[model samples]
Structure formats: structure tokens, C-alpha cells
Target: MEKKLNHLLADLVVEYHKLQSFHWYLKGYHFFDDHAKLEEYYDAIAEAVDTVAEDMLMLGFKPESTMKGFLSISSIEEAKNQEVTSVEAYEAVLADFKYLLDEVKGVKAAADESGDYLTSTKMDDYIEFFSKAIWMVGQEVR
Candidate 1:
């Protein structure tokens, strides 16, 4: 459970940074729309980052709060400095979310198996949000 939570926290942190990068570096026809939406996404990810860390603290485990720690453990890849189209960025976001969604589902399952309902419930919320985000972002991926 600790390992799962820590990995989730790290992925959230890395994904937040990637979203920021996309928000900053994105250009082309969808710039205005994608920029604003990426900002919104990153904001939500930022909140999730804090929430996961707090939950870890509540569970009496120290969260991995450093960039180094996050990069080391996160499965999500960091955004590159190269230029990319809005579609490409959106696709990248969708892919990351899909991957994270599966990971979160696993976390929730483990939490339930461990009888940690609080964490399980929290993961449910994350699952819902990610599912919606995946749908919305998928619309723009092509």
C-alpha cells in the first residue's frame, strides 16, 4: 500500500509538471483552447498531489515530495523541450492519463483488499476524474 501510494504521488507530481510544460509549450491552431484546458488539468493535478501527500502523512508514511524523488519513481515520462502540435500534446496527455487510470485502479483494489476504505474511496474519486478527463481529452487526440 505504501509503495502504491508513493508511486501514485510521484506520478501525480510528474504529470503535473508535464501538464505545465504542455500548457507552456503548446502551439498551433488549438493553442488558446489547449492552453487553458492544460492549465485546468494541471491545477487539478496539483491538488491531487497535495491530497495524496496529506493522505500519506495521515497514514503515518512520509510522502516523496521532491522532484528527484518523483522523477525516480514516476512511470510517466517528462515532457520534452521539442516543439509539438496540439494534437500531439493532447495525445500524450491522454496516454498518460490512461496509464495512470489503470495504476489508480490497481491502487484502489489493493486498498480495498487491505481494508483501507479511506484510501479506496479517495482512489474512486480519482478514477472518476481520470475517466472523464480521458473522455474529454480523447476527443481532441486525433
Candidate 2:
């Protein structure tokens, strides 16, 4: 149970970092609008990361915060470049959101396998959020 929670928290850290990268590096004419929206979105994801890490700790698991830890546990790819155009950024985030939905689904499965109802519930909520965000982002692609 503790291990599963720790793994899920580690995945959250990776997603948080990607969102922050998107927020910082997004560019193009829609800069002001997209930048502000990305910041708001990333902030929410960061909060979720913190909450999940804290919950892991509460469950007596040491939450991993290092990049190495995230890389090891997360299926999501880290952002490789910061020079992406607005369209590229939007596409990248849409891809990340899809990846996140899959990761959250896996987390929920792990939680259920481990008999961790709370973690499973949280994963379900996150999956729903990411699924909706993916759909919204998809509409922005050209």
C-alpha cells in the first residue's frame, strides 16, 4: 500500500514539472492568454502533487521528490525543449494530459490491488480532471 502510494506521488511530481515547463515556455501571439491559463492549470497540478505527497507521508511512505525518482516511476516524458511554439506547446500538453490519464488509471488499479480505497478514489478524480482537460486542449489544436 505504502509503495503504491509512493509510486503514485512520484508520478504526480513528474506531471507537475511538465505542467510548469509548459507554463514557462509557452509562446506565440496567444502568449498572454495561454500563459496565464497555463499558470493557473500548472498551479492546480502542483497543489495536487503536494497533496498526494503529503498523503503518502501520512500513510508512512516517504514521498519521493527527486527527478530521478519521478523518472523511475512516471511513464510520462519530461519536456525536452523550451522553444516550442504555442501550437507545439498546446499539442505537447494535450499529449501529456492523455499520458496522465493513463497513469492515473494505473494508479487507481494499483490502489485497488493494494486495498487502498482513498488513493483509488483520488486517482479516479484526477483521471476525470485530466480527461476533461485533454478534451479542452484538443479543441485548441489547429
Tell me how many clashing residue pairs each candidate has: 0, 0
TM-score of 2: 0.85
Clashes of 2: 0
Please give, for residues 1-142, the per-residue lDDT of candidate 1 as tens digits.
8889999999999999999998888889878888999999999999999998999899988898788988999999999987778898888999999999999999999999999888999999999999999999988865
lDDT by residue (tens digit), candidate 2, 1-142:
6665666666667767776787787778998988887777778788888888877876677888788877887766787656666788788788877877887788789888888887888888888889888888898895
TM-scores, all models, native as reference? 0.97, 0.85
Q: Model 2, poorest ten-residue lDDT window?
A: 3-12
Candidate 1, superposed: residue stretches over 4 Å from native: none
Q: Candidate 2: where is the Cα deviation over 4 Å?
A: 1-3
